[model samples]
Target: MKTRSMYKAERTSLNRLPDPVLETILCLLPTKEAVRTSILSREWRYKWTHIPKLRFELRDTTSELTSDIETAMNAMDMYDVYRVLLLHRGPIHELTLYFDHYWEHYEAFECDQIILHLLRNHTLNKLTLFGLYETEDIWYKLPASVFALHHLTDLHLCTFDIDHPSIFNGFGSLQKLVLSYVKISTKTLLHLLSNCPSLNTLDLHIDDYEHVDNCTINELLKCLPLIEHLTISGDVSQWLVLDSVPQELPTLIHLKYLCLNQYCISGDYGSAFLLALIKCSPNLEHAHLEMEYLLEFSVVKDKYSDVWLAHLNTLDLCFCSSSLEIEFVKFMLARSPKLKKVSILTVVDRKQDAKMVKTLLRAPRASRGVKICTWK
Candidate 1:
């Protein structure tokens, strides 16, 4: 007869599971919770160290912390992040560090140290870094060590600044790059894009700041030769046409989707820029345009009469019911032969809204299967 305690321990032991199975369970839990499992038993002490992905976020804790408590909490949180990184085994494939707006005391040196630790293993392919939203003065300038991760394929950065180094080599394997509210000069932006030859998707919504004199649209367009999906928002749309509406741009043969949010269509430059981009993206399938300001004049149809959206299936237009917008809508209705769905979001009274709906319903259509939906 065997001892009862020994039999129970043997029957319920997690040590019986294979290391791969244990790591799989740890991966399913939150990174914080996964680390806490170290206290469960001796066998689990180092199991979480082998877990590949780590996500550490400083959530808003202002509501719950007093002055002294907040300081201690911040210190503890910072220590936990470093402790996990120092003790972790194997290569970390993905890492996310998000500092909430309430975390105002975070230092740039701390961010640099974290990046340095990540540099120990080149297995990191996907990385996301979000800086504090309120602290514009404190920017985490990307160091040269960041570009050393040649295996990086996806990168998302927010509220950071980029200073192009003289000896820099680009992320050769990068495919998707997203920069939101980032502050980078035109020279640096072009340098970053030119080197990312494998880049196919880009979402750029730069912060509103005075740009350099050399920010020309023609050169910028040339860098994104293989871009498949692009989202441009805020003042960046205006910057692209600061010099003049480009007469010719390299045809974006791979571009299938384009979303322009907070886009300026008010002046000749704005309208011409919009038309020029559409003309170059002949294979565009989905176009989403959210106008920022009311247009001063209707888009001259003759400028883009030869352009036909042969593969377009979806068109989403968010604009007031202005004559300029109506004219653009009419032109799209005539040109898109394969269009399947059109969604319009606008602000209008009941009477004018009905009239606008009737106008679009009566507009000549190249696609018989197209369904038009509208909302206020």
Candidate 2:
């Protein structure tokens, strides 16, 4: 009896599929795996060239085992990665590259060359570079070509050195930008925000306090006029002086969501900040806070409570150390007659506390449309 030829029949059927379908499947794969698919058949050889997404990783190949670790680490040079990117000539919709200092000296030069090559191609819509650190005198600056890529909608840079403000001079079509662990001045950030007029979301995480002096909250807020969502997380302890309170935030009136994490909203300045929110952001519907102390009755009376607690619809309170929870809740209920939903969140796990919240929710409320939730 003769055995059926399974491999030959499957290969023939695969060859019959149209290039678009094959390209779609190839696009779903990582850059390395997509390149490997060329070995499947002659038709599949250049399929990777049509893929829009490009992702390159060096850490994925390194072995953690003691015996093979050294060899694997040696093979994980940045130059090899750069050469691979140089060979790929296609319209990349997304590109992700990660670099490390463990690589040899020659790899740093190669990385620069790869970046220069990327500058020539203007099809990149989303670009992400992580773990990029300066090595020796090998300074890394954002290339001028990147600012001209009008198709770029999202850009994420982590731990990279950007020395020039001109690098972000002409990004008119960018929608989202995220920066972390980068040294950037307020002037540079303002330039970037002014260029990206279509920006909707921004996230900034600064690990060092030294760079805090370069950017003020007011200057940063002025950059994005049409921003709908904003998240600011950093050490604001140094910048929380009462005198630095903003006079107006006319542009931030359209903001629907706001998150302020690890921030100290204490003393009279905290009350002033809340008052500013009331005066500036009339359309703010959702608010989340992890404040140190809930505002006291005397502070609220002195500052005028009616301005700050009038128009809130959704409120989340978390990790508060103040003993004025009941008083605050009562005050909000009285002030926000239109309040729909309220969530009191606690950092510590307390089953009984959650049950007590449930009991409160079940009780009859004086306000007809109000719903309260306590999540522990």
Best by TM-score: 1
Off by over 4 Å in 1: 1-30, 39-45, 59-76, 101-106, 134-138, 296-299
- Tens-digit lDDT track of model 2 for 91-201: 668877665543333443555565556667636789887664544333344444455567788988776555443344567778888876665655566677877889988
lDDT of 1: 0.77
Candidate No. with top lDDT? 1
**In model 1, how large is the Cα lDDT of residue 195?**
94
- Give model 2's TM-score versus the native structure: 0.75
Q: Which sections of candidate 2 miss by over 4 Å?
A: 1-4, 8-25, 59-77, 102-109, 132-150, 166-168, 214-216, 239-242, 264-271, 292-317, 325-343, 348-373
Query: What's model 1's lDDT at 104?
Result: 50
What's the true lDDT of residue 64 in model 2?
50
lDDT of each: 0.77, 0.61
Tens-digit per-residue lDDT, 1-376, candidate 1: 8898886687457789888888889887667778888987777788899888777766544446546754434333667788888899877988877776534555556766777778765488888888766766655666556666777889998887777668778889999999888878778889999999999999997774664334777888899999999888766654554547655778999999998874544544666767778889999999998764665435445767887889989999888887778878888888889888989888777677778878887888833777887788
Q: Give the distance in Å from residue 167's predicted Cα in candidate 2 to where it truly belongs.
A: 7.1
